[model samples]
Target: MLTKYPTPKKLAHANLSKLTEILWNSSNGRFGEWKAQELKNLAHDSFGVENCEDIYSMALLTMLDEIQSLAEKADELEKKISSLLKNFDSTITSVPGIGPILDACILSEIGDVTRFRSADKLAAYIGVDPSVNQSGEYTSDHTRLPLPAKSRLDGLCCCCAA
Candidate 1:
């Protein structure tokens, strides 16, 4: 309703029935009288501010627009990255629960698996290898692995273990 009111003060002062009518008409009557009542109740309960200036409303709207623009850009970038990843070998993506993004992360982090002498070494490099502790005749279960610097890959080891 910002298009119609343009400010929080205007919206707050708007007639309940008018706002309800706008909601109902915009929703093609999907929002019935009951929905309108619910919205009115919510408005009454939530909007405690008596007076909101036009300048503050304008700033809020601007910030909202910027957030929306950034979100759209992020979505676009993700799509582009997914498209690019599709060109690479399908083996990584074929793994269960591994999508384009996770596959990209793995490939980027571990460029060549052959560089590592063994799978254990590769796991260690990825910080997925289990910790080991032994003293006298007692040995720890070695259940935990060190976390990777990149938080994104921290869960990779758990997933692999599972």
Candidate 2:
């Protein structure tokens, strides 16, 4: 509809019957011949004004368009990322609790697992290992794991735990 009437002002002033006809025709009868009253109500609610100059409807429409564009871009990027992740052989995703996203996050944070000497080191790297305190032969039991300084690693660990 914006293609026919680029501005809210133009759309608000446009003939209701003409607009309804255009909608019905353009939608291939899917809209089922929208009544003029229905169209008027829709215009009144959406446009927020009878006069174009008094309303911020154009700005709202522009923002909505921008949001829709960004959403499309995000969906495209997510598809590309998922495709790329599929190329790597990952057993992490096979674990009952983990899915592709968490598996990808874990793999990305712990690149080349051979670099870590042991599972304990890996746990520490991901900040899952508990913190300990000892003083003068009296040792405090490790009770809590400190938050990971690396935010991405923290997210990975949280995903795995969940």
Candidate 3:
């Protein structure tokens, strides 16, 4: 129903904004009524839920279950990250701005930093190096290039900035 033709960034931002609005609106007022009605309609059409009250309860429970599952997974990941940081803590503690966790992330992602020939090369690999346009004698920095290695450079910069 929306008329706006959004660019990539605008579209992404709009989507996130829409999600936030939906979450907020769902908490009260006409939005909650509309959501309930829509859910009832869908449940009635798809699952033959003649009574919307049961469907509403079911939907809420389902959302709660999903949230719980996500929380558990997040906790597991946190613990794993903690264990990893503990293992790499000593090695990465020397780097500025980066503690055990950041160092672990950098070390794990980058593997061996010494393999890089130069800082620029490393920067390019990490995906953070600014792009350069070299056409004839005219040279200037351009946009960032898409690369996996930029993440490594980002971590390095974070370490240095500390």
Please report the candidate that would top TM-score against the real structure.
1
For each candidate, what is the lDDT?
Answer: 0.71, 0.71, 0.57
Candidate 3 lDDT by residue in tens digits, 1-162: 012211222223344445445645656544543454454344344533335645555566677779879999988886787776664424656755665556666677777778898988766777767777688998875665665555555656656576
* Tens-digit lDDT track of model 1 for 69-100: 99999888878889998777647767777766
Clashing pairs in 3: 125-149, 126-149, 126-150, 126-151, 127-149, 127-150, 128-150
lDDT of 1 at 53: 60
Off by over 4 Å in 1: 1-10, 13-52, 90-98, 135-138, 142-152, 155-162
TM-score of 2: 0.54
Error of 1 at 112 (Å): 2.3
| Span of 10 residues, lowest total lDDT, candidate 1 | 43-52
- lDDT score for candidate 2 against the true structure: 0.71
Task: Name the lDDT value of residue 43 in candidate 1.
Answer: 51
Candidate 2 clashes: the total is 0
Better of 2 and 3 by lDDT: 2
TM-score order of candidates, top first = 1, 2, 3
